[model samples]
Each structure stands twice: as structure tokens, then as C-alpha cells.
Target: MLELILALRNALVQQGLELRAQEASDWQGEIPLPADIARFYRDIGPDNCNLATAGNSFFIPALARLWRMQAGYRWHGISGERLTDWHDDWLAVADQGGDPFIFETSSGKVLHDRHGGGSWQPAPLFDSLEQMIACLATFDAVWNSAGEDIFLDDYSVNPRHRERLIDALIPLLNSRSAAQSLADELGW
Candidate 1:
């Protein structure tokens, strides 16, 4: 997991994005973060790197900001009513636009939920945090290297680049189906 996190940091650096290390004390939440997740925040914390594709904006907040974000997702803004489906063990580690990528403390699996779905039900996205970081690193690589011909005027990925992305993701994800699912989720 540390290797994957470093690789992701290196990949982002190659793209000229800067990331700063976070202190362990930064994570003062009542619910303890999984070790790997905590390591990620400590090694490659938040940044405004614009990890945006035509499909989604991948944003991972700093630990300090996580609670507010989680609270909003867990409770209705207007009514301040708690969402029955939102679980205490599910911590939102990242987000695709408004949709959250949740870390399940009990299962050690990463799940994704579509925003405005009106429920907290999330689908399995990755077997572990390591896999999720690997996918992100692969996506960063492919997205940066995609030629102009691989993108339409609207910046959506062309089919060629989409195939390239899936190919790149396969080995990192260790499953063709998982790679394909990630591409589909990215709308590639």
C-alpha cells in the first residue's frame, strides 16, 4: 500500500502537481482510519491538482475536512435529519464529483455511491484501498498521455483511449472485469 501511494505521488509529480505530507495527528476523528488509509493521508495529502476528466473529478480531502463532508452526506441539509442508510463505519475517503468513495471499516472494501440517489447504498468499487490507489495512478498516467486525437472536442475520451485505459488498468487491478468496470464508471 505504501508503494502504491508513493507511485501515485510520483505519477502526480510527473504531471507537475505538488502534494504535501500530512501529520498523523491531522487525523483526530473518533473513528480510527484503516492503517493504509491513514498512511495515504500522511504521505500524499490533499491538493488542488485538478484531477478532473470529462467524466468525473477525483477529489480526496484532507483528514481535517473529512468530517464536514461526511456529516453533510450523512444528514439532510434542510432537515438535519440523519440518513438511515448511512453507516457509522463507512468513511468517505474520496469523491467522484459529488458521489463518494466510501471505505468500509468492517469489510476493508471501497464502495462508491452516486450522488442525489437519495440513499446511502454504495456498490463495491475496489477490494482494498491499495487497489483503488493503483487504479487512480493508472488513470492519471493514461489521462495525461492520451493524445489530442484520443479526445473529442468536448474532452471526452475517444474509443481508442478508452481501450488504452482499460488495457493499462487490467494488470494493476488484476482482473479484466474490474478494469472494465472502472472504465465504465469513468464513462470512457
Candidate 2:
């Protein structure tokens, strides 16, 4: 996991982005982070780099700004009538615009909830935090290599670049189907 995180940092640096590491003391939440998640925050947090620059609105906030789902609802002043099914233990680790990628503390799984929909039942996106990081790194590398204008007007990757991305991600993710699924999710 540490190796994967370092690889991600290196990939971001290759794209000419700066990263900020977090101090151990910066994490003051009572909720404990999984080891790999903690390592990610310690080694690379508060970075301005958008991991989903390929026509996606994803952003992972710094460790200091990380909060749980319940806190987010309260912070946004979401009324009870607007609330949906949410686990208090799920942390909002990252987001694609308002849709959140949540980390379930008890199950050690990552979930993604598409906001502005029906019941807020998030589905499993990644098996673990490491998988999510790897997917991001793979996508970042392929998208950047394809060039800045890789995405079309509708925010979908150009067909050529989409194939390139799928090809590049297959071996890293160990499944062509998985690669295709990720590309589709990223709006390929």
C-alpha cells in the first residue's frame, strides 16, 4: 500500500503537481483510519492535484478537512426530510462533485454514493483503499499521457484515448472487465 501511494505521488509529480504531507498530529478525529489510509494522508495530503482531471469532478480533501457522513449532513444543514439511509461510521474520504466515496470503517470497504438521487444507499466501489488509489493512479497516468484535450465536449474520453486508458489499466488492475468498468465509471 505504501508502495502504491508513493507511485501515485510520483505520478502526480510527473504531471507537475505539488503535494502536501500531513503531520500525525493533524488527524484529530476520534475515528481511526485504516493503516493504508493513514499512510496516504501522512505521505500525501492536502494536494491541489485533481486525480480525476479527465473530465471528472473528483477531489480528495486534506486529512484536516476530512469528515464523516453525519457531520457532512449537519454542516450542509440538510434537513431530516432530505436525509437518506447513511451509516454514521462511513467517512467521506473523497468526492466526485457532491457524490461521495465513503470509507466504511467496520467493513474496510470503499463505497460511492451518487448524490441527488433516491435513497442514499452507496454501493461498493472498491474492495479496499489500496484498490481505489491504484485505480486513480492508473487513470491519472493514462489520461495525462493521452494529452490535455483527451476529453470530449460531453466530458467523455475520446474513443482513442478511452481505448488507450483501458489497455493501460488492464494489467495493473488484472482484469480487462474491471478496466472497462472503471473507464465507464470515469465517463469514458
Cα lDDT tens digits, model 1, 80-122, are 7878788888888878778888888889899998888767789
RMSD of each: 2.6, 3.3
Task: Tally clashing residue pairs in candidate 2.
Answer: 0
Clashing pairs in 1: none
**Model 1 TM:** 0.83
Whole-model lDDT for model 2 versus the true structure? 0.68
By lDDT, who's the top model here? 1
User: Model 2: runs farther than 4 Å from truth?
Assistant: 1-4, 28-36, 46-48, 68-84, 148-156
What's model 2's TM-score? 0.77
Q: Report the C-alpha lDDT of model 2 over 1-188, residue by residue, as the tens digit.
A: 66776876676666655567876566656666556567767776635446754656567666766644335442344543424466666777777667778888778788887777755778887877656765666677677677757867876678888888888778667888988987876667
**Model 1 score (lDDT):** 0.74
